[model samples]
Target: MPIGKLYGIGVGPGDPELLTVKAARLIDETDIIFAPQSKSGKPSVALNIVQDYVDKRDIPCEIYQPLFPMTEDKEELQRSWDEATDVLYEKLEQGKSAVFVTLGDPTVFSTFSYISSRLQNKGVEVELVPGITSFTACAARAGVQLTEQDDIMVVVPQVSEKLTKILPYVDTVVAMKTSRHLDVLEDCINQDPRQKDIVSVQNCTMDDENIVHGFVDNKKYFSTSIIKFRK
Candidate 1:
C-alpha cells in the first residue's frame, strides 16, 4: 500500500482570506486535519482560519487537535510532542494524508516544524507550504512598512538582551510573545528616541483584534509589537 504524505500548512495569522490557494486546496483534499491546541480540548486557531476553505460534503475529513502546551518544562513539552507524533503516525499508517494547520509561516516559531521532523524520522513524507506571517500582516494593516530602502528588520519571538542590543542598530523590531516581558521590552524601547514609533497589536487580523498605540500594563495573550526606528 502507498504511504500518505503530511503537509505542514501555514494558515496565516487569523483571517480566512489570507490563506494561500494551495493551502486551501490541500485542506479540502486531505484525509485528516491536525491542529495544535494550547490544551487537550481547546480549539486551534490555525484550524479556524481554514474553515471556509475545507469542503466535507463529498469527502469528509477528520479534525484532530492534539495538545501542544505552553510551558517551559522540557519533560512536559517532549511528552506532548511524542503524543502528537504518535497520533500522526497512526493516520499515516492508515494511508491517510494530513494537513497540520499552523498560525504563521511554518518555519518561524511554529510547532509544526518540530512535529514534522519527528514524522519524517518515523518515515512519513512531509511537505511544508508557506503562508503570511503575523508581523507583515500587522504592518500592512497598520500602514507601517516593516522595512524600506536599506532598513534593517529583526523578528524576535521573546524578550531578551539581544533585543536591547539590536535596538540601536535596526529600523524595525517585531516582538512576539511580549506580554510576559513587557517591562524588559518597555525599558529598552523607552531609551530609544523613536519610542513613539512602537505599537502593540493584539489578535492582528481577527475580528476581535485590537491595535494599541503604545505600551500598556495589560496586554492580550496573542499580542505583538512593531517598533519603527529612524533610518
Candidate 2:
C-alpha cells in the first residue's frame, strides 16, 4: 500500500472559529490526529482549538499527543523530533492519513515543520494548511497596524541582542514569545533614540487576552510585543 499523506494544519492563535475551512475539513476526514504538547501531562493548545471538529467527526479519529519539550538544546530537540517522526511514520506506513495540528502557521517556528521535513524525506506526501498567525492576531486585537505603504516589518522569534541591529532597518518589529525576554526587549528599544510605540498582548484572541499599550514584565508563554518606530 502507498504511504498515507500527512497534513500540517495551523489552528490559528487561540480561537476555534479561526480555523480555515480547509483545515476543518481535513480534521474531520483524517484517520489520526497528532498534536504537540510542551510537557507530558499538559493539554495541547492546538488540539483544544480543534476539539469540537474532532468530536463531531462521523468516523472515530485517533488522537496522539507527542511531547515536544520547550528547550534550546539541539541534541535533545533532535532526539524528540526523531521519536515523533518514528511514531508518525509507523502509522503512515500502515496507510493511515494523519493530521498534525499546530498553533499559528505550521511553517513559522512550529515543531510540525521539523516533523514534516523528516516525513517528506521518508517518502510521505506532506501538505500544509495555513492559519492566522499569533502576531497578526495580536495586532488586530490591539488595533495596531503592522505596516503601511512601503514600510518594512520583521518578525523575531525571540527578543535578543540581535534586535538592536534589526531596529534601525525596519519600520515595525513583532517580537514573539516575549515572556522570557522582556528585559532584553526593553533594553533594545531604549537604545533606539527614535520615538516608538509599543503594544504588548498576552494570549491573543483567547478569553483571557490582555493588551497593554506599553511593555510590562509579562511572563505568559503566549505574549507578543509589537514595536512601531516613528519615521
Quantify all predictions' global Cα lDDT against the true fold.
0.85, 0.92
Q: Model 2: per-residue lDDT, tens digit, 1-231?
A: 999999999999999999999999999999999999999899999999999999899999889999899898999899999999999999999999999999999988888889999999999999999999999999999999999999999899877667677679989999888887877878887888999999999999999999999986857999999999998
Q: Which ten residues in a row have the lowest lDDT in candidate 2?
A: 158-167
For 156-185, candidate 1 gives per-residue lDDT tens digits of 887777777777788888988788778888
TM-score between candidate 2 and the true structure: 0.97
Cα error, candidate 2, residue 54 (Å): 0.6
Report lDDT (Cα) of residue 130, candidate 1: 96
| Alpha-carbon RMSD, candidate 2 | 1.0
> Top lDDT: which candidate number?
2
| Whole-structure CA lDDT of model 1 | 0.85
Q: What is the lDDT of residue 63 in candidate 2?
A: 93
